[model samples]
Target: MTDKAQKPSTRLIAVTLDEASIGHSTPDIEHERATAIWDLVEDNAFFPCGDPGTGPYALHISLMDNRLVFDIKREAGEQVVQHHLSLTPFRKVVKDYFLVCESYYAAIRTASPSQIEAIDMGRRGLHNEGSELLRERLKDKVEVDFDTARRLFTLVCALHWKG
Candidate 1:
């Protein structure tokens, strides 16, 4: 078996978050958004469904009319498909995720290792749920693995805070 690392042809070369849509975020929220985008660009498999031309894409995420918009384009800026997903489906999970995250952040300083671990575990669980939902919601529009979905989910949450 060849141990060659396969190059990801269908991956995001750039990601943009609408600053106006993401108004007045806390430092923590801003950091989370940056990290998620960085991770997604560094390593991800984001293939646009159907025929949207070839590899290497750029993604612009924004919120419009309480819907999440994914404006995809070619690396050189050719227009591709645009998808708008309603935020209603993600409300509960995102809310819970934020609550758990708050607890986990609070636990980091004062709680015991076990306590912190437990809170982090719950936080991860919520994250996974959000990721799964994102994958399911975008299944028809975009094809993304669990990891990619997770990072995308973080971006979703980032947009959701203002929505």
Candidate 2:
């Protein structure tokens, strides 16, 4: 076998949020959505088990029937894998994340610098927690770096957001 085939390098070339299905989002949430997709496409590692080809993949994220769906495809649009992860595990984290983000935004506008920094720290902690959870949930299906999981978690939260 060729060296390249033996050691595959994986990445995401594109990411799409199924906004129509998830309903509308606030401008803040929309901004987060755009940022996550941009960061993820710019750099990430995603290796779906059993795929022979190396990839710069395309990912479509959506929420359906309360489950988060990861629709992965090759760069040329060939199907790779569709992973459906239950939202139950993420319910508390997502809710907490939203609350923290709201506080952070408000703090930025009215609170002292120290207070804002504290809230921002909490927000980052919750974000890390959510990302770690995602990594665990996808462990069996795909291998992704913490940074990739972090960005994916942001998109997942965007999918879960109702407002």
Candidate 3:
């Protein structure tokens, strides 16, 4: 029997965002999308449960039928898992996140340093909440560290953005 240690660790090597689904997003949203993908590729722990294949995975994130889809594949392009999660649970949080982000950005322009910091803190809190919700939603389907989930949540939010 092969020892567990002999198996390759599961991690994401590349990530793609589906443009067709997302349409045209704001520059801020685009930046967030790019940054999240970059951060996720640079460092992440991603393991698809019930899949025996060891992987440096490639992920394609998109929205379809109001669901968030994770199209996962091995580095070699062989498909591993495709999981679709309902967006219903994320709607309120995403909306709230966007609102808080807008406030934070506006605050950065004119609010006092203390005010900006306070807004920033609230923004981060909402972001963390969204990430935690994402982790919970994916618990049965995938195993991911908090940071990975946070980055993934960003991408998910980008996809969820209407404008």
lDDT of 2 by residue, 71-154 (tens): 989888989999999989999998999999889988888999999999999999999999999999998787788888999998
Backbone clashes, candidate 3? 0
lDDT of 1 at 117: 94
Q: Which tens-of-lDDT digit does each residue in 6-113 have in candidate 1? A: 234578889989998889867877887888899989988888878443868899999999999999998888888999999999999999998998899899989999
Tens-place lDDT per residue, model 3, 1-163, is 1233224557888999998988987887788788888998887888888878578789999889988999999898999989999999999999999999889989989999999999889899999999999999998788888888989998888886766
Better of 1 and 2 by TM-score: 1
Q: What lDDT does each candidate get?
A: 0.85, 0.84, 0.86
Note the residue pairs that clash in candidate 2: none
Show the lowest summed lDDT stretch of 10 residues, model 3. Answer: 1-10
Q: After superposition, how far is residue 86 of candidate 3 from its true place, in Å?
A: 0.4
lDDT order, best first, reads 3, 1, 2
Look at candidate 1 and tell me the lDDT of residue 115.
Answer: 99
Stretches off by above 4 angstroms in model 2 are 1-9
Candidate 1 — worst ten consecutive residues by lDDT sum? 1-10
